[model samples]
Target: MGIRHSSAGKMIWLLALASLIHVSSLEAATAETVKQKPPRLNIVFIFVDDQGYYDLGCYGATEVETPRIDTLAQNGVRFTDYYAAAPICSPSRTGLLTGCYPRRTGNEVWVHRPDSGTGIPPSQTTLAELFKSEGYATACIGKWHLGFSEPYLPANQGFDHYFGILHNLDSYEVAHFEDQGGVPLLRNGEVVDRNVDPGKLIKLYTEEAIGWIEERVASRHETGSSEPFFLYLPHTMLHEPLGVSPKFDGSSNWGLYGDVIQELDFYTGRLVDALERLGIADETLVMYVSDNGRGPGRNQQQPIRGSKLTTFEGGLRVPCIAYGPGIREGHESTVVAHAMDWYPTLASLAGISIPKELVLDGRDLSALLLGETDTIPEFNQKVSLNAEVPLRREFHQDLEWERIFTRQEYLNAFFYHGSHGALAAVRSGKWKLALNPSLTLYDLEKDPGESHPLNSWEIKTKLRGMAIRFQREMIEQGNSN
Candidate 1:
């Protein structure tokens, strides 16, 4: 009996010893993983005003030279089917910064002029706010057309620093309204220059951005801090009444427009080179996108119909390039992407935790950007819209403007066209239902220009149902609120 008990005790001791050894090994492995984890990446978002889909050399612009932008595409991923959230400027920028449709934020029509009282509300959280909250240095250097009011400015919206015009350069001399003569160039909410030269604005903006970047880097090195940065550089080039510096006045065969684009490219190159020199190129995510499509008789947005102010492909589709570390070189993604997607995409890339309470219309593109997946997961779903999901109204604010959508509206791939505060059309996948002038159905894949209309009952039914459901839900949600 004693001998049997001794044998059992020995076996128990051996098992206990093995378990401890396994636990110790796990602890060691976990510590190593924690130590080797990469630091959060910096982000540089370059937003240009009114650049067309084919404006960049890589996107098939034979007339204008965009060597730097072309190099950016060659070094990273270029998106062919990328689109601006709105067909015009103000709403497009609102979507980009907030990750919500322009209508949702109450700015749908054209851009805000100096006389406009309304602007992006203070209640909405911007991209700069998100980065700032995460301890990242934030700056906005260039055009800020959202608002010129005290509360609507970039500084109030979360930028640590802001240097640019309140509205378009044309606002300088050409008065859009009485008492709104010139656009005042500001720095951190103070009017720095009221009569700034339009030709020198681009160069000035570039220099300011570079100086900020250099100072930020130097300060970080001096302090031995590892804090990342978020730079939102929105250029005013290519907008109507385009002007270029003396050095690049007649540089392109395609005329003044091409000259402006080339100079834009040169400044872009300078910025990228600065990053490389600072040895942060591999630790940063650089993206280039246009605020909206170009105007008529400007840069080419060929094979797509309609221009700025219209809800056609030419007005919505714009060039998008993603460069820097982890992005596959020379890769082209035809996946459907929007300007709003950048809000969530950048958050994911920088390892920032997105607020769970926030209703985001953007999808995380980290998998696609990292080359892990060819397409976004949402696109793979059989049924895009899930109406069964409960709609949540977390933040309620009473404003002068009406709300466009609830959280439920973002569940589907449906895009609402509200260029002038009225629903002109609704798009779901390849089908577009036009409600203006006349009821028409178009298959964008077959007729990108919306030149041909398809007579299909099935498509019309599907699209009509989506539009009806969206409107119904919006009304119901609004009443409940």
Candidate 2:
């Protein structure tokens, strides 16, 4: 009996040892898998209106100070050759949000007047909506210049909460606009707060944005879920009729424009501080870009020859920076990226798939931001076309613009606008060609400031042919739509 009991004990010990070894192997495998997972990234997009490329310190501006925006570029990636989809405000915003070309939505024209047609078609899907569907809590603060009426507001789109002006604020003073005051201070679509001070607008928006961060964090903790949050904060201070808070009224030596830019910098610092305080700074992605180029028109020191209406480089080239957890730091990408690229970039970062049916002109720049690509891929670039195809029958009833544009004289007059129109540029690597209406070819790589026009007609003819082809492609896309 004692021998039988000894055999049974030996068998039990052997089985127990095998079980322990299997459990250890499983735990080790689980840990290895966990280590290989990609980190989640949260996004905080800061968009400023009418901010020039030289407005920020990182962009080579020594005259004015922009410490916070400068730090963002210093800590992450600065896009030196960034372009807006349009020289004006609304179309640019449309392109940024939709990830599609402005002309695709038939809104290349300006939308300054209150009674202007719908900015971006309501039928289009927005970036926020895509992110929200991916479990991100989205909010848009400061400026929503895409549309001006019913079914076009932020909440109507995909934003969970929105606080700021629906249209672009032309004047900085609160007293300038009468319809801005009183109730929900406009909640979900209803007027919420009556009588808001323009001087206090930035502060109010900041506090509200902070509240959103805190609320999302608390909600996530309570639900035991890990989800990212998106904050689209577009400031209106740096634009025309610049206004600064009382604290920064006399802070700069560069006049009102300088003061307003400084104030915007301060606001940026405040938002960064808020994110840090909430302990979500490292998890969040912050992208700062201007809505368009300078708005105060031309000056002796800063000659903005066309102001907001022109398509000059001064009107299209704007400051852009991206800082986040996964993006490389202290690098400058001369890749010619446009504002339209933001929507697709953000969607890609969140691991959300863009709808296949909806055509997106922009490319996902994840590889570019991660330092995986030394040169921009040809498949990921954009081509511009300067063509005039009249849409409304009434608008083209008087003359056939098609015949005129096909002729060489029309091209000459177009480039003679002196406002930067009648030109189409296609950039890949260091080679860039600007096809002007004068049948002139400009190599932007050697002459970035566009000081000298090229003397080669062959190259110009090739560029013209390319531009014409691009226009035809656009028309084909439009017809398909």
Candidate 3:
């Protein structure tokens, strides 16, 4: 009996010892996994000024050479149904930066001058502010048209580094430069170059951007940190008073405009190459988009129908591309995406949150970017304060500004306002109803160009009601603001 009990006790001891050894191994493995886990994503947003939807090779520009930009589409996702917040600059930038309808923020109707007192309100939080909250280095290296003044400047708007012009090159009081300060180029609130040359901006921006990135990386290494970065490279070229590098002068079949595009493509390639050289390419995500579509005559195919500042499809829809880590490669998503979406999408990726009181107009697109889902989910806007999903798709505040926009009209709808803030059109799914100029209902799925209008009264009436209600809500928001 004693011998049997001794054997049993020995067996139990061996089993417990084996269990403890397994547990210790697991704990060690867990620690290693946690230690070697990748850092948060580094984001580089490349926004160009006054680019056309069909201006890039990826978007079907045969006259201009955009091979480098096309490479992004070949390697990543290109958005066909992407629309800018507005058909113009200041309003578009406001929507993209604030993630709220421009009208909601009260800047959709005007562009900021060099000496303008009114700019992006200081109360509104920007994407830079959001990224900064999560310990990411933020820099704005290019045209910053939000506001040229103190509070509206990039520095006070949450950017750690700012190297760009406060307003557009054309905003200068004089048309020509006389070697004196015409348009100032600022670096961290100091005027580094007076009488800035428009032709040289692309190169300077690229260099400054890459240099800033390198400095940030070096700082991280010196401090033994793994912090990520957010770089907003809003290029200053391609707008009015267009200029290109002498090397790229007359390089394309299309004239100076094409040369400007080629230069843009070249500099964009440089930025991408820098990311790869830094070994952060695979861990970084890059977005290339335009602030708004080009003005009349850039693409007659576009302007003949509707150009920038108009409520037509050509004016509102623009090209967008998402590349690098966490984004599906070589895919063109037809989902309706917008400029404001980036605000929430980036925040979600960084595991951060925006202010609760702020009404967010963008939907979280991280799931789509990560290859988890294709369709953007829908939710009720009323429960926005604590909702798990996005309230709706989007509302075009500048397609045509109506006096009022009722928020509770439709969960999934888009409103179009004109440059002057008139509510001109409303869209639901594939059906688009144009109010101003004419009450024409066009099936966008079938007639993407708005070439043909269907006499479907039912569809038109439904969309009209949606628009009227949306306009009512806009009035409410406007008054409250």
Candidate 4:
């Protein structure tokens, strides 16, 4: 009987040992999986309204003190030849968000009133939508001029939170010809104030942005979530009818405009400080840019001809600063980049897959921004035209138009000017062909001011032909829509 009891005890001990081994293996596997996951990346996009190409200190403004914006450029990469998608407001924003040319959405003209029926279509995918799909919290905290209707607001357009005016802050004044009375200030689709104070708008925006970041961080900590976030802060300071808070009043050498700019710089510094204090500076990507060129008589645009209304370098070119992880410090890139490129670049950085069916006019700039390669693949290669047939009219709603350039006609660098539905000019590398009543070609490299007109029969003929073809294609695409 004693021998039988001892054997039963030995069998029980063996079963316990096997169970311990199985539990230990399971814990080890979990640890390894956690370590293999990539860290989440955050994005902060700061867009200034009607800021000039040389408005900030780093970009070369002596009167306007912009230390914060200058520091951002010093710490990150600056683009000397960056261009906005359009020369105006609404169209520029549309192109930036959709990653397509403004003409593709039939929004080439500037949108002024809130009652305007035109806006970004619901069928299109926005940058916020792409980021939100990957579990990022998205927010827009300034100047939302895309649309004013419930269906067109930022909340319906993939942003988790929206706060600011539905259109320009100056829309509240009665002097403007297109004034829609007082603009509605909103928070999450609800009207908080009808007539917002322009003097306090910049300060208020900065404070709200800081608060949003803190709240998001605390919530993530409590929930133990590794999800990232996207913040779009579009300031309305430098536009017409500018005003600065009492603290910044008469603080700059350039009067109220300069004072407003200085205030903008300070508040921007506050945001950067917040990021550092919250311990997310290393993981966040901050981009500072302007919607278009500055307002006339309000800012300087030396060496670049024309202003906000024309199809010239001054009208399209704007300051661009990129700072954060994975970006080379204090670098300048002359590779022509547009506002539309941010869509694909940000998505590529976050490891999100773009849909195969979606057509993108912009190329992924991850390689160029990361210093992995100086050359962008296919940047200079001509696009093939015969590979795909023309898109049918039914697909027009989807913006399924033919490629902009054919392989034989493609230039190393090209920019089309579609201001107010008219193709005014075409810039192919250093040559610019303007078709305002007559065809005039100029070499921008030699005459940055565009004072001298060149009479090159060969270059003019080639660019003129390309322009005519482009116009014809645009007309055909419009008819299809």
Best by lDDT: 3
Top-down lDDT ranking: 3, 1, 4, 2
The candidates, ranked best first by TM-score, are 3, 1, 4, 2
Where in model 2 is the C-alpha error above 4 Å? 1-31, 34-39, 171-185, 295-307, 377-436
**lDDT digits (tens) for residues 1-481 of candidate 4:** 0101123332332232222222333245555443444346688999888888877888878888887888888867898878888887788888888776677676777664566776888878888988998899999999888876776789878899888876775534323323434666778977777666788889888898999999999988999988789999988767777989999999988888889989999988888889878767766778999988863323334577668866777788889988776666678877767887787677765656566555555666665666645644343211111111111111222122234334334323345555575677776667888878788888877776677899997778667666665556567766755
- Native-structure RMSD, model 2: 13.3
Q: Which digits, one per residue and each the tens of the lDDT, describe model 1 over residues 116-174?
A: 78888897889899899999999999988897678898889889999987677673424
Return the lDDT, model 2, position 162.
Answer: 85
lDDT of each: 0.72, 0.63, 0.74, 0.71
- Across 1-481, the per-residue lDDT of candidate 2 in tens digits comes to 0001123332332232222222333245554443433325578888888887677778766657888888888877899778787776777777788876677676666653455547667788888888888888889987677766666778878889888766545543333456645212454565656555456667777788888889988887898777788888877556555667889787887787787778778877888887777766656778889877774323344433334555556767788998766566678997777876777666655656566566766655655765556444323212101011111101211142343233222121111111222335644333345544454455556655555767765555544554554466567776766
Clashing pairs in 1: none
What is the clash count for each candidate, in the order shown? 0, 14, 28, 1
C-alpha lDDT of residue 435 in model 3: 95
Best by TM-score: 3
Worst 10 residues of 3 by lDDT: 1-10
TM-score of each: 0.84, 0.79, 0.85, 0.82
